[model samples]
Target: MTKPKLSTPAPVIEKVAIANRGEVAVRIVRACQELGLTSLLLHSEADRSSLAYRLADETLCIGPAEVGASYLNIEATIQGALSGGADALHPGFGFLSENADFAEACAQAGLVFVGPSPESLRLFGDKISAKDLVEKAGGPVIPGYQGQDQSLRTLLEKVEEIGYPVMVKAAAGGGGRGLKVIHRMDQAVEAIEAAQREGLSAFGSAQVFLEKYLAEAKHIEVQIFADHLGRVQHLFERECSIQRRHQKIIEEALSPSLSPTLREEITQVAVKIAEQAGYRGAGTIEFLLAPDNQFYFLEMNTRLQVEHPVTEMVLGVDLVKAQLLTAMGRSLNWQEAFHPRGHSIECRIYAEDPYRGGMPSTGVLGFCHWPQGPGRRFEVGFEKGDEITSYYDSMLAKVIVWDENRPRAIEKMKATLRDCVIFGLRTNIPFLLAMMEHPEFLSGQMTTGFVDKYFSRPLKEPSLTRSDRQLAEAVVKTLNREGLGGPRPRGPDGEAGPVPSPWGHSWRSGL
Candidate 1:
């Protein structure tokens, strides 16, 4: 299929309804403020206390705490937007960001969906269709079977043709869900069933396809933006090679591993595919770079990505603002030749136990504070007294840092993570800090398997040094006086730990 003829009329948007919640919604609200637009936050019962509510100009209750009833309910979302008198709706990253039906519904309702058209979403929303479009545009896609034959027999046959270790990927969704690797024929049927079920459950689609699994591959993606005027520009590439269970945990800009020639070729290919699909607004074209430097198109994300901040930090461009402009019918001011100014890294802060099998932990947050200063940005979604529920994603914030180059960026991230304090629960801070200092990570020699190679199992907490002890002592005293949740970290010697400032706790705190 070729790019569809673009003819959607652009409207003058004055208010944008943020159709999702959490950090991305918060970011979009700020972007709307900067662009002189009102932000209408569509939230659920679970997000009544979220900071997005305070930041947005107004709030509309969609449904209960469950995501399906609120965030993913298209009818409720459209009703809220229409009732709230919004001219446009921004779906952030997850939820209905890439739902093609939602995009079509918004257009029919006379509201601009701050994203690509329904056609673009349908073409690229499915992994199979996206691969076909990339191939039609002369982009390299990994050899695999994307035929309409989703039968168990045909899938097994395709696996046999592609050899063992083939990947079963959900054609209709992302976020690392509905993906399974079958190393042998014995695992094929089970993996396929599980992937299909998950695909249906998560994305409302049961279709799945197969792909060749590259054991040592780097997850790289290019940020592409296009206006309704047929202008396309790439903001450059981001290396999300550090991941766990196929979900990215850490991301960086200007990958240390990319050769200049290879980088240019892959990113241009990304733009090529975007034009082929008539892509607009903020979208990501993901590719997998093999060890030999041969990259293949993986899929296209038809909405804003979770790790877009790393690119913003390096390029000093607000992608959310740019997206707003494009949605408002403004042409892109993106230079044909854009140069990234600095190196940056983003560490996802999740409210989970990194030392205990990465289990999800939830409760009322205590004295939550983050580092502040130059080059340190903490994009968060919660406050001290807010409850952390299991209904949503575990990610609480992202600690992003920028510097002159990669080395300095790493060091800055280290300092920022050390200063962050989030009492009342265990977090992934220790795991992230250790991952940064890992020899492979420091040398920039990493792939998608970096986490599994070193963190196959839960890691034990590293012993705290003297400075760490002092920081912990200060945190304990502060929280104690505030009558917050969390106690002093106990030392290995049975004394109050003068140890690390936050993250691990002596016990899980309650509301």
Candidate 2:
């Protein structure tokens, strides 16, 4: 299939209803403010105390705490947006961002969806269809089976044919929800079933596809933007190889693995694919770069990515604002020759226990502090006194840092992560810090298996010294005196009794 003709009329947008939550919602709200547009946050009941709820110009409770009844409920979101008098709706990644039905409903309701056309969504939403389109565009695709036969016998046969260490992915999944690597024949059934279950639960699709798993492949993606007139521009690439269970944790701009020639080749191919699909708004064409420098199309993310901040930081551009402008029928007018300035790195700060293998840490936040400094940017979603619930993603904030070079950027990110103080939750900051110091990571030669190969086991718990204990006691005393979340009397150890912190009895403050 060739690029579809562009004909959707751009309407004037005054109010943008954000059909999402967390830091991305906060991101959209701020962008709307800068563009002189009103932002309406469509949130669930559990998110009432969120920072995004507080930042948006208008707010509406779409449904209950469950995502199925709220964030993923098409009718509820549409009704909420319409009732809130929004001229447009922005699904800031995940949930309904790439849902074609949601985009069509927005158009029917006269609300401009700040994304590509519904046709484009449907085309790229399915992994099988997307791969076909990419192949039609003469792009390199990994050896995989995207055939319609989803039966167990067929999948098994295909897996045997493709050999072991194959990747099983959901046909309609993103963000690594239904992606599994089958290394052995005995693990095939369980992995495939798990992938299907996750796919059905997360994306309402159980169909899966198979791929040749490149063990040492580096995850590289090109950020592409298309105007209303079918003009597509490449904002360069992002290296997201440092991932856990296919979910990216640390992302950087201008991958350290790519040569100038390879970078140009990959980016141009990405542009070609986008133009072939007649893609509009913001989208990312992901690829897997092998050790031999050969790259293959992995997938396409048809929405603003979580790591967009690193791209924006290096390029000195605002993608959220660009999405809004595209929705308003305005041209990006990007420079033909754009030079990426400096290096930027982003670490996703999740509310989880890193020492305990990243177990989710949920509770009322006691206190939070992000050290202010130049070249450091934080996209936070919660504040002190806000509750971190189990109903949503564990991510609390994104810490991004920019510097003159990659080495400086890495050091700056390390310092920034260390300076962050989240008193309530046991975050993955320790894990991120360790990864930052890893020799493979420092050398920029790590691949998709970086986490599994080196950092798979739980971290060694650090012993608290007498001075650390003293500092903890002093901090707890201050919190008690200030009546922060009420006073916690005393425990057996008499160390201020947990203080609503996720660390339980231990009170190792800050990152």
Candidate 3:
């Protein structure tokens, strides 16, 4: 008798080009190292002295400091990858991550784009097309007008039918780029025009559609994966309800409000959207959950997300590794729902002044230290002496923590935020800590408006005690010396200012 055994094929890529910068780029580089794949970091001149530049196997300068000239320059990015001998490219969260033409270009150039095919990218990139497919897949899409009739007259008519307080969104925009919320008929046309202008400038598409904007809804998303073998799986859900200006500031797994039935239904809907589109690779299906528990599919991000670490911490799965495996034509190890091991939370640490209306802070980090513990995972973009530039997103790092339950996780996060030290720029740490202790948040009853309703600065100024006044006087002096007491912090345009290094302070009392 004779027997034969089949050997598994290896993953697809040997070398990967990270076509972005900052924390996400560093995330990709680390994943490549773990998988034994060579990493080529395509960076801008501003990021040349950054941390990811040294960690990757190779680094190539794509263009100057401006994002349009560097990270968003498709031709230069691809050229850098090819010149560096990279066989694949991983577009981290921003920049060209969701650019369909970039995906097509990579395919034509014989390079594997780690996310999805150009078709998938194009389908989901356009809001109109995405709505059509969600309906086809039997997923609930927000009621709106997503027709191809681009005439202003036609749009105005649709807006009238859709009623007031509708959201005008760019057909091919993301990250709140081409979005406008109009609450009256008179504001509809202007809103559409503004959104179209933003769309044209940001995504190179001026097309926009009107959708009914649900007020005070919760933002939730399902982490999903699809392989080359026609199999799809979900890794539970994350509640990203805490946000400001439509951008997520905090994320957590095992949404506290969802019942068992609602969870199953929502996750299935997310899977259906992916299956109907023949989607491959890692992606997220975002939805707006109403107070009554009715969820509507918002959009699908066809790549790894900024809050992916929270999912990883709770589920004990490496999404980047799974992305690599799926890109290599392998199926998920288990084509079913993954059980979460614990509760996890992520706080986006931005270089912004929350007190001064969240103004972006750009300079050198005077001092830097992240929390370290068993369940703490930091995805940092810079080093101790790194420059926190204004050329990109204001987020500088992420602090992800895990525990056996939600309350414990929140407590750990509060302590972690208090212990960390950062200097030379204002941050949102105090704001985040306040959120952790807020009654609504602690009770797991948060909506998208939670921040504005609860965290808005108190109207009346409380009397400061003798010690309080003394401390405030000291802080003002320190801030003035550090150059943070001036007007808005200017970005790196002509002459960049020196980064101030001073002793950092929490500067806030309990709510």
Candidate 4:
């Protein structure tokens, strides 16, 4: 492989254009300002007044609400970058972050893409190809087929050879969009056809691959950073076993279930895979740990992950800063071997209706509130009056908590979720609350299918505990005593009628 020619490291990036919107776009902007770089934002016509657009140093309208014409349009993003005089492009997580074509386009235009090289992305973005590369690097991979013919007859033969209950996954898919579970030969044909259709529509790639499915598996991933100097380091592991329909709902660091020796073994394999791919910048190596203690390589994500904050909280490192410095050809300053000190958990709060098959919720937000206090951190995108639309992802915020142990962290998260509120749109708050209260979750007996099995019950209206109810009553009484600047007025029935308080309006309404 030919090495990239290093040009006298472009004047330390005075300005950067975030190529996506929402919470991640805001996140990149804050990171840029910390490094003394001006932040630029690219928005669609519908998001002209978004909070992120207002916070940016400058904003450019890319196109209409259709993602094809706006967020996913590589040419428009590049034009926006050049017109805004941006020296670098931060493809925040989704959309163009993992797109090799987009990354190469940025490089060819002389704009720095804040991620691994396009070659590395291409090598790992395709599941079939990535499996071969991992095996070459001495990593264990599930036995499966990577061929294209996928005819029903051929697939059945392969399934017979690999054993029953295999997973049919889109080669170019992520976020669990195009995956299906097949348990017997009779179901293989229909599963493959449906997956192919979804993959074609969603990703414009109909390629699918087969893999041996492990039941009740734990999903763990290692965070690795590689610099331009051929050095790589691992930042330990994150357990993302709590998922629903292939999407992660909660993630934690220093997996409560893994032994110390097992953790080290996984980290070493992750480092080896990174070195084999000639990887640079921040990337995640995912693995599925079976009940028997054996682990198989899942796919590699060649960009900064949404759950990266949990790792940062426990390791006391800024992964975004490291990515920026690595893009500028700087080596990591920390030691090669780092250990996590405490436990950290992150819960994703989305504007969606969990009761209605998790359909995305869209409306104008009337009130926005985030949790606070010790061990709580909220990364949000929308404020009051912001519109939640179906044009983009449903995620509105990520609430993370850190503590000295898993149980404490779990409790902190439960309280934080209760304190957060978003009015005027249906949210998954009730579902999140239920998950936190599950016995299996608290005991750390979680798996990728935990949500599917335990989340069968429909969410009911949340009830306040006795102490919370008492606090609410006291707050209501105080408000009645001080009614809107005048002496408290009694109703005809002799009861305080609809006492108003700025702080307890929603609480009193039981919303």
Return the candidate ranking by TM-score, descending.
2, 1, 4, 3
Question: If scored against the real structure, what TM-score would every candidate get?
Answer: 0.90, 0.93, 0.87, 0.88
lDDT assessment of candidate 2:
0.92
- Best candidate, TM-score: 2
Query: What's the CA RMSD for each of the models?
Result: 5.3, 4.5, 7.6, 5.0
Q: What would the per-residue lDDT of candidate 4 be over residues 1-511, giving only the tens digit for each residue? A: 3332334653367788888888878888788889778888988987864678878888888889888899889999999998988878889887888889888888877788999989998998888889999999889998888897867788778878888888888888777778888888889888888778877876678888888887799999999988767688899999999888778889999898899899989999999999998998899999999989899999999999989999999999988888877776676688757767879999998888877767788998878888688878888888887887888889888999999999999888888888887899888887888898999889988888788787865665545566765676666566555452222344434476453444433233432
lDDT string for model 1 (32-108, tens) is: 99899999999999998888988899999999999899999999999999999998999998889999999988887
- Candidate 1 minimal-lDDT segment of 10 residues: 1-10
Whole-model Cα lDDT of every candidate shown, in order: 0.88, 0.92, 0.84, 0.84
Indicate the TM-score of model 4: 0.88
Best by lDDT: 2
Model 3 segments beyond 4 Å from truth? 1-12, 456-511
Better of 2 and 3 by TM-score: 2
Give the per-residue lDDT of model 2 (tens digit) for 136-248. Answer: 99999999899999999999999999998899998999998999999999999999999999999989999999999998999999999997777899999999999999999
Cα displacement (angstroms), candidate 2, residue 230, comes to 1.6
Q: By summed lDDT, which 10 consecutive residues of candidate 2 come out lowest? A: 502-511
Q: How much does candidate 1 score in TM-score?
A: 0.90
Name the lDDT value of residue 147 in candidate 3.
86
> Which residues of candidate 4, in runs, are more than 4 Å off?
1-6, 9-11, 184-187, 461-511
Q: What's the lDDT for residue 161 in model 1?
A: 99
Give the poorly placed runs of model 1, Cα more than 4 Å off: 1-10, 462-511
